[model samples]
Target chain A: MDVLSLPFIQHAILAGILASVACGIIGSLVVVNRSVFLAGGIAHAAYGGVGLAFFLSLPPLPCIIGFSLFMALIMAAFTVERRHRMDTFIGVLWAVGMATGIILIDLSPGYNVDLMSFLFGSILTVPVSDIKVMAAVDILIIGAMCGFYKEFLAMSYDMEFARVRGLPVRLFHFLFMALVALAVVMTIRVVGLILVMALFTIAPYLTERFSASLAGMMVTSTIANIVFVFTGLWISYRYNLTSGATIILVAALFFMIFIILSRFASCPRKP
Target chain B: MAPGGDQQTTVLPEGQSRAGEVPDVEIENCSFAFNSVPVLRDVNIRIYHGDFVAIIGPNGGGKTTLVKLMLGLLKPQKGRVRLLGSDPAKSCRRVGYMPQYSTGEKGFPITVMDVALLGRLGLTGIGCRFTREDREAALGALRLVGMEKYMNKRIGDLSGGQIQRTLLARALISNPEVLFLDEPMASIDIDGQSMLFDLLGELNKKMTILFVTHDVGLLSRYIKSIICVNETVYFHHEPKISPDMASLMMGTGEKCPVEMVAHGIPHRVLGRHERD
Candidate 1:
């Protein structure tokens, strides 16, 4: 109860809710489209933005957002025509982006910040300004998704069919990549870059067991993420453990439990 | 039919003929290629309203390419493609397409209803709710394919035939003027295939249809005309295949010019070709 009264803790809670909004919506798309690898590359490549922000002494939120968006566009363009060879290009970008971040950080004058927080999240340290940024991004993501819902669903289900129906499949793809970039950047504050994909993927994957449609999956995933974030926060506060790691650990535990239960439930007669 | 089968363009003067009489689709001197390799060259086709046409050719013979050009999924390097008297891409909302089964992802998490509702996406740009009308249309399409009971069912849970039917419902939900189907028979059983062809035949009374498949023998009975596509195209206005033409189509003789079949072909052999 005392922790609830603390402003930092309250900010952390707000950040968690906003992160769940993205994790629920964009994460469902990422899982359904089976673009987990592409999302992972973008998430990791986002570190370049963090490095750039540090080097430029700019506000990390917009700087990282811009950098991640630029990287996502490049990835989208590369994968458009030569999809069979996409993995090679994605891998190259992943490495190069990370390398650029590390070199930039090293070159930055007297920028000796603790890198672990950026890598693994520092939700308790999320400032009010960052929370505002997260909220704006949440609004942006939700609004775009609502406006492009059918187009996204059609493209996800059958891209060629969407293309034939006069849907701008390529344009939607680039826009979706940009959204993914924004989601990754906003989420980095709550779950950190290294573990963000887990949060992005796990909720939707777990919800798929019961959800019949993409919208259902998103709703169920949002609720599940809320549960995970709150429970993980309480447990981390009690044990004085790392909040991001604890949240992911809680989700992983639920994932394992569901797997075991579903396996048995599906084949109850099996030995 | 043109007396000489070299090039035929029957575009009616603007505002001369009634809308119903205008050809549903027209392609003139269309050429397409992937990479440096040419897939289709100098192809021309006209599909009138209410025509049930089958596009049949050997594997890699550009059947799919011609369909793509017509649907505006791919641009022809040099040609004009018109659908419903406009650019195919611009009038695409009036076109329904069922791509090959292999293109659909198996084990994807989606319901039959949601898949069918994809047809209604063109009715409005994003943000609007799925209206009651949209739902009813989707349901009606599902009923057409006899999968209304499975509308709520997950697509992955259905059998191959059931999935194909669901896809048909998706394409039909829009109530388009023309339907383009690519190898839709690949996964269905013979009975299901028969029923599907029957459904397409019934639909042809109101809509033009362009079916792309290599299994011409199975489809020739229902289709009213055939378009044979290789690197080039040969448009056959009639489905009644002469015995000699049938033999040539089956690769029994040296390749005769497709134009020869329109006029009674002399005994010219066709180059041996393999069926897909």
Candidate 2:
């Protein structure tokens, strides 16, 4: 209980809440659009920005955002133009991005960045500045989602119909990808790139089965994410374990329980 | 039934003749291909206002492709497609489209009302919510499709026929001048199909109806014309399919002539083909 009063623990909790805003809203879009793999690719490729920041002695946040946005554009282009080869393209980019980041960090003279913290996050060490950035990104995400909720819904539901309805489908696709990049970058401080997919997908995937609407799904997923973060943080703090890995494990545990329970619950009602 | 001819044998439906009116949809020498393989070749079609058209073709044929062209979803490599006097893309707001039912996203979370409201996307501006009028219009469209009772239900929970109706409501919510439906009858039962055709017949009085179907047997009495597509497109302005036309549509030329006998309104008997 005393750990909760610590400023660092409080910052970690705030960081988790901010990350969940992005995870819940953007995660719903990503899952519904079936772009989990694409988002994962962006998350990993964001490491290139981390490395570039180290190499150039620049701020990691802006560098990661810029790099991730660039990667998202490329991925979006490939998805829109050549959909058949998108998975392969994402796979290639995912690896190349991580490789570029590692090489850039290696090339940076006399600076040994804690590689494990970037790979698997150090949420406990999150600073106030990073929390401010996450808060700002959350605001931008909420604004975009509010401004274009129907557009995003239409696009995700039936893209061809959306195009016929005069919705700029391709433009929305690019914008959605950019938002995914921002979400992924913010989440890196909480759960890192490797575990980002679990946070982005698991809660949304679970909530999607029961929620009646996209907004409902987002709200439930956000709440579910908050629960996961608080629970995982408590367990990690108690056992002195890795926070990011513990959080992801907690999500995986809930996902398994949900699937099993839903399966059993539906079986009895089936004729 | 010839592939690329301007032969006008159309018997316009009663009380719906617009002889000198500009076509609601016009595709001039439009040829489209995918990966250098032609899907629709030198296709020309002019659908008049208030005409009910059934686009019929095989699975791999260009029926859906032709509809996509009219909707400006795909560009023709060789020619132009115009809807309501402008390019298809420019005139899309006045057009309604119901795409082929896809089971791929069956579990997608959306309500029937929300799906129907999506039709107003063109009218609704960015950062603006759907107004009370928009909700009423969506409800009206759902009522027309007999789905108003299920407006609040999740679209994923609907049956195949119900899903089709919800999608139909979505297309109709915009009050479009021309409506394009791709395989609307795919998963519907015979009774549902008949009821849907009745609804479409009623709608044909207000808007131009062009639908793609693989079931040639379900051609409604309201269908004014039939567009048979393969690699090439053929416009049969009459509902009746002649033996020569049937064979042409079969893609077997004169060797396999098929005979069709009209028995009653919306009923036709296809005589056995003579194969050589």
Give me the candidate number with maximum TM-score: 2
| TM value for model 1 | 0.85
Where does candidate 2 stray beyond 4 Å?
Answer: B1-20, B253-265, B269-276
Can you write out model 2's per-residue Cα lDDT over A166-196, one digit (the tens) per residue?
8888899999999999999988989987899
Candidate 1 chain A, poorest ten consecutive residues by summed lDDT: A79-88
Q: What is the TM-score of chain B alone in each candidate?
A: 0.80, 0.86
TM-score of chain A of each: 0.97, 0.97
Across A1-271, the per-residue lDDT of candidate 1 in tens digits comes to 7879999899999999999998899999988888888899999898898889889888888998999999999999987543667988898898888999999999898856657778999999999999998999989988987777888888888888887777778888999899999998878899888999988999999987578878788889988898899899899989999999999999999999999998888895542
Worst 10 residues of 2 chain B by lDDT: B255-264
- Candidate 1 runs further than 4 Å off: A80-84, A268-271, B1-22, B240-276
Q: Choose the strongest candidate by DockQ.
A: 2
- Scored by CA lDDT, what does every candidate get? 0.80, 0.86
